[model samples]
Target: MKVVLASASPARLSVLRAAGLDPAVEVADLDEEALLDGATGATPAAKVTMLASAKATTIARRIADTVPEAIVIGCDSMLHIDGELVGKPGTPEQAAERWKAMAGGRGELVTGHAVLRTADGGIDRAVEGHAVTGVRFAEPDPAELGAYIATGEPLVVAGAFTLDGLGGWFVEGIDGDPSNVIGISLPLTRKLLAAVGVRVTDLWESD
Candidate 1:
C-alpha cells in the first residue's frame, strides 16, 4: 500500500518531507465557490472543517483506483476574522488588503485535515478530530503588506501570508504549531499517519 498526499500546497509538501515522509502528491483540485455560499452564521471552525472534508472526499474518490490500497490525506485551511471566513486571496491587491486588516490585529488560522483510508472495500474517514492549531500575527505595516504581496507568496496562500517565510517576522507569536501556519502541522500529520500504521519515526527508513 502507498501513502498519498492530496494537495498542491508547497507548504504542506515541505512539512511532510521534513517529517521524513516521501508520500506521493496529488492535488485536491477543490473549488471553494460552493463552500462559501452565505454561511448565514456558520462558525469559522465549522466552515473550514466542511471545506476540508469536501476536498479530502473529492480527492479520495478521484484517486480510488490509483491508490486503491493506500491512505490518502486531504487538508485545507482558512483565516477567520470577525466571524468571517477568509479564503485564499485571488489577487495581489486583495492579499494586500487582507494583510492590512489582519496585520496589527490578531486572527485565527484554522487548518483542518481529513484522512481517508480504504479497508475491506470500505472507506474510513477521520476529520480534524486529530489536530487544530491557532496562530496570531504581529502588527504589519500597510506598506509591508504591499511589499509582501509583491513577492507572489500571498497570491496562492490562504490568509495572504506564510508563517514559514518572510511573513514569519510579522508574527509576534503563535498559540499552536507554527508549522500549522505554513499549511500543515507535522505533529498532527504524525498522529493521523499513525491510524494507517505509518509512524513518523518509521518514515525515516522509508524508501
Candidate 2:
C-alpha cells in the first residue's frame, strides 16, 4: 500500500524515510488554533489525537479521488509541562521564555497519530493513538540560551526544543521512545498501521 504523510514537518518525513517508507507529503491546511481553542476539557493526549484525526480527515478528503488507495498518516505534537500544554513557540521571545520556564525541568512530549486506510475513494479503516515521552531539560546559561535563540531553531519546533537538532544541546535525556520526541513514533505508527489492517512492512519502499 502507498504511504501518505499529511504533514509538512521535515522531522516527521525524515523519520518515515529513515524507517524505510518513502511517503508522499501533503501539508494539511487547518485552523489549528481554532481546533485547540474549541477542544474544551480534553486531556493533552486527547487534544493532540483529535488534531491528528482532523488533519488526516481533511487530507483524506482532498486526495480521495486522486490517491484513493493508500494509508494516510497524520501527526501532531505538544509539550505538557506543569499543567500547561504548548506547541511551537512561533516567536523568538516566546521561545526564549518557554526555554526559561522549561530549563532544568521535566516535561512530557506527547505526539498524536492518526492512520486512515483509504480505498475506493473513501476511508475504509482508521486508527488513532498517542505516545508520551519524558524529556529532561538541562539548564542553559544565559549566553547559551541567547545564542541558541538567535539561531531561531526553537521557534518552529514543539516545546521550543528539538531532540535531533541544535536544541539537543539543552536536552539532558529522554525516557520512552526518542522517535516520539522527534515528532513521530515508529513503534506506535507500526501498531496503528496494523490496527488499520495494513502490515507495516507492506508500505516500505522496495530496494
Top lDDT model: 2
Candidate 2 lDDT by residue in tens digits, 99-169: 98999999999999999989998988999999999999999999999999999889999999999999999
lDDT of all predictions: 0.73, 0.93
Residue 12, model 1: lDDT of 89
TM-scores of the candidates in the order shown: 0.86, 0.98
Model 1 residue pairs with clashes = none
Poorest stretch of ten by lDDT in candidate 2: 198-207
Q: Identify the runs in model 2 with alpha carbons over 4 angstroms from their true place.
A: 205-207
TM-score of 1: 0.86
Error of 1 at 65 (Å): 2.4
Look at candidate 1 and tell me the lDDT of residue 182: 77
Instruction: Report the lDDT of model 1 for residue 169.
Output: 77
Model 1 local distance difference test score = 0.73
What tens-digit string does per-residue lDDT give for candidate 1 at 1-207?
Answer: 566787788788888777777778877665677666755567676677677677777767776755556677777788877666787898987887787788667777888777777655456655453244566677766677667778888888888877888877787777777777777777777787686566667657753
Model 1: lDDT of residue 58: 75
